[model samples]
Target: MPRKPTNIIYSANEKPPAGTVLILGVQHATLALLFIVYPLVAAAEAGLSFDDTQLFITSCIIFMGIATLLECLPRPGAGMLLVQIPNMAHMPLAVQSLAAGGPALYAGMSLVAAISQLTLSRFMRALRAVFPPEVCGVAVTMLGVALADPALRRVFGISGAITPDLDLRYALVSSVTLVIIVGLAIFSRGMLRLFAVAIGAAIGWILAAYLGVAPEPNASFATLPYIDIPHLGWPGVSFFSWALIPAAIITGVLSAVDMVGTVVSMQRMDDADWRRADLDQAGRAIQANCLGDIGTAITGGFASASSSAAVGVAFATGTTAWRVGAVSGILIILAAFSPRLIGVLTIIPSPVIGAILIYAAAFLTVAGMELILSRRLSDRRIFTVGLAILTGLAVAILPGLVGLTPEWAQPILESPLSISTAVAIVLNLVFRIGIRQEASREVTTADNPFTVATEFLEYQGDLWGARRDVISMAIPVVAEGVEMLLDTGVAPGKLEVRAHFDEENFDVALLYEGEPITIPDHRPSPEDLLGDAHAVARFVGYMLSKRADRLVLGTDGTREKLTLRFEH
Candidate 1:
């Protein structure tokens, strides 16, 4: 059955206040610090000269500013109608690809990837029903599982190569960082809890610096410091760069997954019902993602995702009122003019940042896993999803094992995100639709005992085992007067007629013209009725019997209508 129309309205007039912009700006800045660092470091590692690095960084900042502005601004029929930011998940893959192929090739791949995703946007709504909560939950869980090892390696300062001769000092720094993070999470309150990762990283950095475990601070800030335009280079679509296509597609898929989760979370937070229109809104959101990707690729950066931080900030500060897109734009532009700011961020010890990310990623992974398990699937479905996720993780960890297979199969086997998404999609199709479960017992007026009893009472009031409708005459008057009574703060349960009707009738019944009136076996509780009086009244109105012969006349000469009056 189609869902009933929702009366709840989400309008521009309901936006957050102006003062909330400051809070949102702080959130953007903090997440910007975390998100931008990886791209800068990646650019530096990809053999870009300092000047080139500065130029790339400046362009990236400008791109982020532009995307953020488009996302946060209240555009007319453009934008996601929500705040968006650079996606973090795409960074690792983009960076890895950049390491193999130079910046130009990386940008080229990104352009293709963005265009593919953009073209695919229209199909997203059509495909969404296929990826129900269960399927998406499994896919997201698999993504986290695949990334877990890399996150750990970063935390332990074991990037590039792992050896038996482990650095004891680095281990100590990581251990202490982990402890501080865990402690703060357990003990902190409010804003402190929210920023526990950042604070923990700061503490670890301070300690690491004191012990000389930190990287040498290159404090010479003289680098090209001006806003630079993005250099658009055509990527080589050769077999070598084509190897990067899987990663690009994975980036797009994961971005969609993340967006879906974020949208569902937002809907729950706002008490909004998901509708077909909402699905269109999501497609538009993904379409907007292509714009962010274009910006990132042109500027020699990785693709970005929606900012969960912005959502948190919006809720925490109650600042849903103003447009912070402009603020993010200005900040990014300012940062672009001073590339030295990027270098300053580079001074933070990698171990500290890695430790913070380790915890953050772990939290994200656990949450994603829980999202999968929370869906009420059968044991077989659960096992299938779990196995697929574990297989994806194994593929990520043992890439060489998969590489031993035929070269033709390498791409399909190597990309964990794609493989997992595919596996989940297939398994869900098999389990949910192909081998469907048998229908359980059906309930109807003739079959259900409760329904039969209620119908009996309606037909012959106080006859057989039927209950009387002594207060039927008063129902129409109360129903008519309810709107006025509700406006005057008269609680539905507290109303004398409501209580009387509930008492006399075995089940609640209402009568209306030309409608089938049958008492509902499971009448709502007083609390339920009073809390949502409008809904209850509307439902009662809907269920009332409209047949002229069905309505009764009271001995008092009152017109017997569906009334809330009954005898206890």
Candidate 2:
């Protein structure tokens, strides 16, 4: 079923008021700070100096703003209003690279990764057959699962902290923060709801300060320089890492999934007429994202990503204005020079960031599941999705158990996410999966309409045991209907054919994005369709009038659906 359309206060393409843009920009900036956990934690684990950490994180923030700006600006392939931040998915990989080879190793490897991802995006349209929504959904769900433990651990100050204990004070701060965020998001009206995360962080910060959280920022806030920029050097590749190329390629694919999901989610949120994804736009967005990563590496930050947090902020605020993100990017760039502001920003406790992560993880997990369920859930889908998610979770909790995999493969298998995504894709190919899935088919312009329509009806027609003459008759009618539709200037790829059968009713529905098409009660005369002296075309016109028991054209507010019912 199609989702009922709702009015959007600020769409992706449209610009809201300057005040509205400013409001959303600040909100988005707050959402972005959560991702700082990536570089900061990775830096700490790698034992980098305060100066090295600042330079690295500053690079991330600066390039993040640059990436966000490119993503927002009007371009042939890029969508508007997209927000880019430090991607948490790449945190582990980054930490590994940074710890092993310092910022240089991380930067060089990140450039290669982005290039690989850019290559993938160019060919994304071709690979849709292999990685359909079901496969992608499993991959996406696994990502959320793989990321959960780290976030949940931080909620109690277990990860990246001085006290890795279940201290009640930490728990209270995190829980209260989570409660406030969830409360405002669910119950509050207007802008208050949009700013929930920021508000929750403020409350959590104040609470943590009062309780004297152990990991306080050591940088003296009052005496911090009014403005400062760290001296930076160019990144050089270190031979400290193994499997750099394969790691870049495989992880790049995972990033592609993240890119596609973010684009689709934003489209669904903003566009009333979103039936099919704009693959070109998605590919372009990936290109922009790739540029961000490369820029981050060259400039000094770790690789960047399109954060689920940004998407959540867009959805929550009902503001998908590109200017908002662009302005936010500007603010981010300006902050890189402000030492006092950086110290204050860093002071937000880990638990608060953890609470934010919890919300994003939950949102992304549910969104992935919804994408799969939106179409149909087959037994294979259930198994594939379940297996992938469970495998990821298991690996996260028990990495030692996966130690049997060869050392060479460990780079890919070390994380449940990488393992599960690889597993799902392989299983999907082996099963020709979408197994036991619904009989719906996507309409693509690459195939001839007449051939597609004939095969579609005949395949379903045979199972129903419809008379050969009836099956034969119905095929041409469908072909003619489709050809006629094509001639009317409707893009072939925008149309879909979905067939459903019951004990008594055999229904073939044509779903397309266009003005509603009317199938008239009167049959077309042979002369009318015999243009160019085509016999088949003439016959089709005559048969189309009498084939189906009922032909009804209706609108789903966004697209027109034509249902053809044949009496069995």
Candidate 3:
């Protein structure tokens, strides 16, 4: 059962009121700046020239705008509000390619990866069933967990010779800025909450300017060329740098978690009729995202993925208007014409950007955990999610582990996201035997947990050709037991309902980690209906005895298990 969504001022596919569009669009544009930081940092580490870095940034900015427009548009995209940019999953590969060959090698590798991802559009529907919310959640969390350190570096303002020292002032500015963003988002009820990042960043920039860590307002932007063209020659691929092929393939596959995870978040925010992953819509979104990046091959640009910063802005602003996507694209394209804007974006206080990245990463990581935990944490899911996350984090953080890998394999293995996603998917299939056998699941709403239970039974019914009428009859009495269970204020992720079949009977069990309580045969008193939780449980037990064939109460260590058997 899904809880009715609250305070939904705008949905992912719907347009906000026209009056609010431009403002939301501006916030979105500001958020899009967060995408450039990854590539810029990668370029610095690769020791790219100032000119090559400029071209790289310019290409990515324009491509991000293009991808976003395609996604926001209905013709070929999922028509959801999305912000697209180069994915960080490929940053290590990009750096490797750049160092091994040059911009051409990087560009060529990116082009291949982007195309491979686009091809996934055709199979995303079938693949969606394989990569359920549980697997995707595990991969997404592991990806963010790997990024936490880079975000910390940003907070410290130490990238290279430019800002080599870890400034204490950077910490102060970022901390205060983070407080402002979180505090306003928590306490404010107005539109100000939506602009918390912009507000906090601006305030932090002012503070940072005083501490000599940020640039003061100046007209240096005026000197930027109004109409500059970027034409850095693409590097040539050589036999010596064949390492790029494998890197491209690896990133192309794993980067999809970013696209799918972002769309899932939007769907959650939309509170739509079917919040489950709509594979068709997601495929279109993926294609649109990929189409925007094909230009990088010719123009030496970074490939794109959905932008977390833009999504964060949407949650903060309480708007997911497609218009924001459209207008933000317009702004990004427009921003390209003003060299000053690019300069400004390139020089925004590093710590502020770091704060934004940390918050985005935190949100993504928590969202992944919530997605996985929203279901029954059966042993299969536990091992799949836990092993994948832990193993991925180890590969990402532990240097010695990566060093043990073969030289050519190090690039792909170095990316925790790629490895984690592969592990989660494989483990999901391996564990399906046990998971399908248990047929256990969890729901979020008390209003209709029974509906969920009944639906699940019907599906499990098909496996044995169990009669629909028999399943229908069990629904009413089953509904009562679940209603009572939900009324107990069970903690989230604690309730587990299991449905299975044996011979000629269908069986279901409600399991939770708690003490086994007594269920009374008689109706509970008025006091029981008011504040007494046990009274409701007792009443539910009474009802179950009459409705179910046999109600059994049992305990397995810390868990109290209630089994409801229906024999037709």
- Tens digit of lDDT per residue, candidate 3, span 382-407? 78888888878888668578888876
TM-score of 1: 0.63
Cα-based RMSD of candidate 1: 12.3
For candidate 2, the 10 contiguous residues with the lowest summed lDDT are 532-541
Better-scoring candidate (lDDT), 1 or 2: 2
Residue 529 error for model 3, in Å?
A: 28
In candidate 2, stretches whose alpha carbon ends up further than 4 angstroms from where it belongs are: 1-8, 47-51, 89-102, 160-165, 219-222, 237-242, 271-274, 433-568
User: What stretches of model 1 exceed 4 Å from their correct place?
Assistant: 1-54, 72-106, 171-186, 219-251, 261-278, 298-301, 306-330, 405-415, 435-568
Cα lDDT of all candidates, in order?
A: 0.52, 0.69, 0.72
Each prediction's TM-score versus the true structure:
0.63, 0.73, 0.73
Please give, for residues 1-568, the per-residue lDDT of candidate 1 as tens digits.
2221232122222433444444445445544655676566677667677666655555566666666666555452133224555555656555656677676777777777677667666786677545655555655555455445655675666877788876666666777887776765566555554445556667888888887878774546565354544443333332367667776776666666666555443443343332212455556666766787787677666566665544433333322332454565566656655545655665677676556545545544554565554433455566667876877877887878886886435545666755776777777666545431111122222243334333433333321111223324333433443332233232322121212111113222222222222344455455645644454553343334231123231222221234432332
Using TM-score as the yardstick, the better of models 1 and 2 is 2
Worst 10 residues of 3 by lDDT: 230-239
How big is the RMSD of model 3? 10.9
The root-mean-square deviation over C-alpha atoms between each candidate and the true structure, in angstroms, is 12.3, 10.2, 10.9
Better of 2 and 3 by lDDT: 3
